[model samples]
Target: MKIDTLQHTSHRTNLAQNIARVILGGFLVMAGTSHLSWSRAEFLAQVPSWLPIDADLVVILSGVVEIILGLSLLFFTSRRRQVGWVVAAFFVLIFPGNISQYMNGIDAFGLDTDRARAIRLVFQPVLVLLALWSTGAWQAWRKQQSGD
Candidate 1:
């Protein structure tokens, strides 16, 4: 059995993917923390009445989940695909929150308009892509991870 230099190159590529995961994970943690720091009333106002939980609790819990998922990515590099799955789940779960924010005219870090809020919605998939990229799924699947 002969292992060519290509194997070493692929190994390095995987290592780069792992590093990207850590960077993205740290970024997500910081973003989630910012949400946590938001005024509870402001966030509460954004939550729709249809959701079961209190608005304040929902806002806080969402931040906690984001932070946890982000941190998990850093520590669970070997399970990149599994982490991606979890992250995708989080994205789906929080999507309603994003919609609520948009509909309620909530200013998320001063993003006030529905258009601004709606534009922000596009990034959710990009975050998922970052997660999937960490798993090298895009490489295997031949899909554009980011719209750009």
Candidate 2:
């Protein structure tokens, strides 16, 4: 099936959505900074042992990506939908790391218990949904799918 290049173009976000987007962006920027700096070691605990890449390298690269995605969300008005999709996918891509943390019972970011880690896992989808909803990506895709 052919994909429409324009299918994920951005739409105007209302005040609440815009606020949420900005907050999410700020959160990403902070987390990314932590990955590159003080929290680098903490983030390492999340890297799955089976991943062939050097764990440090993975952390560093993901940090960079998070920063870029965060900045895009903060400033890319005409392309927020695209950025939202990318951000959502980024969350999904990194989900395995969270799973690894849980499976290994690795404690980091104050998640010292299995219960805490499991709860953190639950928030991953919330972040994904926030990216979609705050940027209007979810609505845009639904409209397209329904042929509206």
Candidate 3:
């Protein structure tokens, strides 16, 4: 009975994780689409002013990259661990943009106030955690660290 319970719990966990992964992928794709389309200006507001590249070009390229990452997350089950790591890194990499938005008081995505922007920044880490946990990347990393 205990073994059966364990198996059931494991299955439920996997199902939840897969659902979360799909949701995150869909969200990324939608955001990416927005970056290239109606919300281009809004995305530009998030780009750090100190970045040397043209903001529009950066937004466009990041949009393309986001689409690719989202597709990989949704379809590349065999490489999910790697994808998760990359996704987490991508989140980390883009964090400076969020900080820039807050520090510069650039309003975008309904985050008009400094407090709102600061709150938005808090979610980036959650995204990183989501990317890692939903794909079991965190567990894999732990196992590797312990040399299991």
TM-score of each: 0.71, 0.93, 0.89
Candidate 1 stretches greater than 4 Å from native: 1-16, 38-42, 137-148
For each candidate, the alpha-carbon lDDT, in order, equals 0.70, 0.91, 0.86
Q: What TM-score does prediction 1 earn?
A: 0.71
Arranged by lDDT, best first = 2, 3, 1
lDDT of 3 by residue, 1-148 (tens): 2332211222212888999999999998998999999999999998998899999999999999899999999998777877888999999999999999999999899999989999999999999999998887877776655655
Candidate 3: list runs displaced more than 4 Å. Answer: 1-13
lDDT of 1 by residue, 22-134 (tens): 88789768767865895555656667779987777887887788788888887765555657667877777777777878887778656788889999889878777777777
Give per-residue CA lDDT, model 2, range 96-137, as digits (tens).
999999999999999999999999999999999999999889
Candidate with best TM-score:
2
User: Top lDDT: which candidate number?
Assistant: 2
